[model samples]
Target: MVSSSQPLASLIGRKILDQGGNAADAAVAVAAALAVTEPCSTGIGGDAFCLFYDAKSKTVKALNASGRCPEALTIEKLRSLGFEGDSVPNTSAHSVTVPGAAAGWVDTVDLFGSKRLSLAQILEPATELAERGFPVSELTAQFWKRGEQRIMNASPNGHEMLRHGKAAPAAGEIMKLPNMGKTFRALAEQGKAGFYEGRIAESIVKTLGDLGSTMTLDDLKNHSSTPVEPISIVYNDQLRVHECPPNGQGITALIALGILDSLQSKGKRAFLDAGVNSVSYLHTVIEALRLAFADSKFFVTDPEKVHVPVNELLSKEYLAKRAELIDPQNTKAVAHGSPANSSDTVYFSVVDKEGNACSFINSNYEGFGSAIVPEGCGFVLQNRGSNFNLDPNHPNALAPLKRPYHTIIPAMVTRMDGSLHISYGVMGGFMQPQGHVQVLLNMHHFGMTPQEALDTPRICIMPEEEGRSVVLVEEGIRPGVVEGLKALGHEIQVVTGLMRANFGRGQIIVRREDEESAGGHVLVAGCDPRCDGIAVAQF
Candidate 1:
């Protein structure tokens, strides 16, 4: 089974599976396809992270393929450019980093794919779609138009991504990106060296250099993916959830889960008050997430630079201490409990018949990224560096060769016996981790199916200064719940129409241990209807 935010992308993954590819191969296919069909959110000029569960080894491995700041990019330079202290403009060339998606795709396929399938085979579907156009989906067209009107038009040569050499293609309008297909063909013939070392790499360097950037070809060539141990926490002793370490925000979901479990174990009945949509459950989880984000803001960064006390933060002693701050009756902002821890784009899950699963996420960050599509290169560069702070004293402050705080993450859940249960992720700017915690609890604790968990209304707490919070709630949420949350002191914005898509587009695959049939374990999956996504199986 394969799922993604674009139907053709998901179909491409299912196609790879039908061709006998493993989950890893299917992942590469789907990610590549999304870059073609959903260019507003993802592309070759981006970054990726994935969680791969090797069922044979009964272990999950994490890959961090996020790119780093340009070797010449520095806080002093950004400060001089008037981007003082977390004020980096999203449109600035400095906001663009060395893209890692191409390299990440190669690394994942090399590490986990079968010998039967090569990178060319994996990327075939995407290349075909890019060569011959595909119709734009509604949500994608909306974002595409937003970029064309707001950012791309002002950017030098950014309009190249627009259809007909003009505005963004409207929904259902067929658009072709032949240059991207050429780039993919190059990758097919030359592998990682194609993207990081040759024409594509040269285009990336010249694109940035011509636009007042300090980037060099060495910065692009130096980028490589890593095989890292996935950090995990046993949640409620019923299942274990895993996330990538710092530099990505996966740890926030784990922290929120730890806090929720600690609260319930202490006889806090608010969680059990009602179903997934209940006010009590919503408020409690939101507050717990508040605490999680506080610590995440204080400590989450690229651990390669500063020491991040991950073990100390995930310790039961520290979590229980953090849970003590939540008040069941009255809701208020929670403080960091002295424990430190831990989008746009496509978030998809692929599970093969062999039981291996890959939870993957790819993004250009902040809606069309830097909006700097190089001439004839056929993709946009990521504004991921805008996530960095300009404060020289800050851990996530801009620096040469440093990765900024990232928002894209892939998540997986395993049963107590170490069997994979769920491979999932949600894609949006900051709504990702909040979406993760809510969807997880809905399935495990509230007994919702994969579809129900994703379909449920979501609420995100927009962090303001101390003692204040702004919560964005989907319009489908009950009116009484809105009043109740407002009464609890949250300033609410009820989002509707296209605006509510900000909650995130998610995909989930649940490998039911109890479900067995002629096909073996039943792979239940669902995709967010909020976007043009789907879930499919070859069985």
Candidate 2:
């Protein structure tokens, strides 16, 4: 089964699977295809992260494919350019980082792919689509059109992203990215060096330099993806949930789940019996997540640059302490617990016939990413550097050659014996972990299927802005539950229609390997109704 927000991209991934490629190969294929079909979320100019389950070994491995800031770009450089306040401009050339996606793709294949397929073979489907063009979907077109003016004004070479050098084409219009196709073809023929050391790298340097950026060719060449052990927590002693380590927000889900487990242990909680949309269940989860975000924001940074105490934060005793802060009857802003733990993005998963599953996510930070495109590159340079904290005392402080705190994370669930059970993720700026926890609980505790899990009305605890925070809920949530949450201290906003995109667009595929369904596995797939996406399964 292969599922993505874009139909053509999903079809491309399934094509790779049909050709005898493993899940890892199909993952790269899907990601590359989505780059062509959904430019508003990801590109070769961005970064990626993955959680891969090796069916042969019953082990889960993680890859942190995110990039770091340039060696010469520092807080002082921004200040010298008259930049003010505690943040950098999202649209500035300075916000661009050395992209890690292309290098990451090669590494994923090297480590997990089968010898039956080469990088060129894996990428052929996407390369064809980018060269020949595909019709834009309604939701993606709406998203793309919103960024047309921003891309034009902020990027020196942004004129290339337009239709006839005017506005973006509407939904159903065929859009061809010949330059992106050219770049993909180069990667296919020459491998990683095609992206890191040759024409692609030169375009990166020349374009950024023209826009007053400090990025250089060497910075592009030096970037490499790291293989890391995935971190997980056994939830309710029945299932284990996995996420990548720091520099990404995967831990936010673990921390929130840890707290919920603690609360459930206290009887102090109903677990899930309060009804799916009950005010009590919603309040409990929201408050726990708010607390988790507080800690995640305060502590998560590049592990190479800072020490994030993952063990101490996810510790049962520590999580229990954090859970103790939640008042089941009411809601309020919760503060961070001692340095504990832990966007415009795309999330997709593929489970091959052999049970090897790849849960992957890639992103260009925010919309159209710095709104900057390299000359003739047909992709946006990510503004991930804008995530760095300007405070010198902060752990995520802006520095040379260091990664900023990341928000994109992919999640997976495995049975006690280490078999892959669920591969899932939710994509939005900060709604990811919130989606992870809710969808997970909806399935595990409430017995909802994958579709029901995603269809449930969601809630997001917005980051604290100037010490004021609000909880945004979808309109379909029962009116009584909304009133009850407001009755508690929550300053609630009910988002409706297209605005509900703030919640997120997610995908999931569940695998069943029980005796009743032996020999062949049953693939239950679900795609987010909020976006123009579908899940495709092939037995």
Q: What is the alpha-carbon RMSD of candidate 2 to the true structure?
A: 2.1
Error of 2 at 498 (Å): 1.2
- Give the total clashing residue pairs for model 1: 1
Model 2, residue pairs in steric clash: 343-428, 343-429
lDDT of 2 by residue, 83-116 (tens): 8887677888888888989988888888888768
Which digits, one per residue and each the tens of the lDDT, describe model 1 over residues 1-539?
A: 98888889988998998888999999999988999888889988999999999999999998999998999888887667666546478878888988989999999998988767889999988999999999999888988887786545545666568797788999999999888898899888898888888788888888888877898889988888888889989988889999999988788888889998888788786566676667787888888888888777767788898777889878888999989988766777656322111136779999998999999999988778888877677888898888787878877778899888888989999998999999999888678888899899889877899998999889887866566777888888999988887777778889898877778889999998653586557889989878888899877
Model 1: ten consecutive residues of lowest lDDT? 334-343
Candidate 2's C-alpha lDDT? 0.86
* Candidate 1 stretches greater than 4 Å from native: 334-343, 514-516
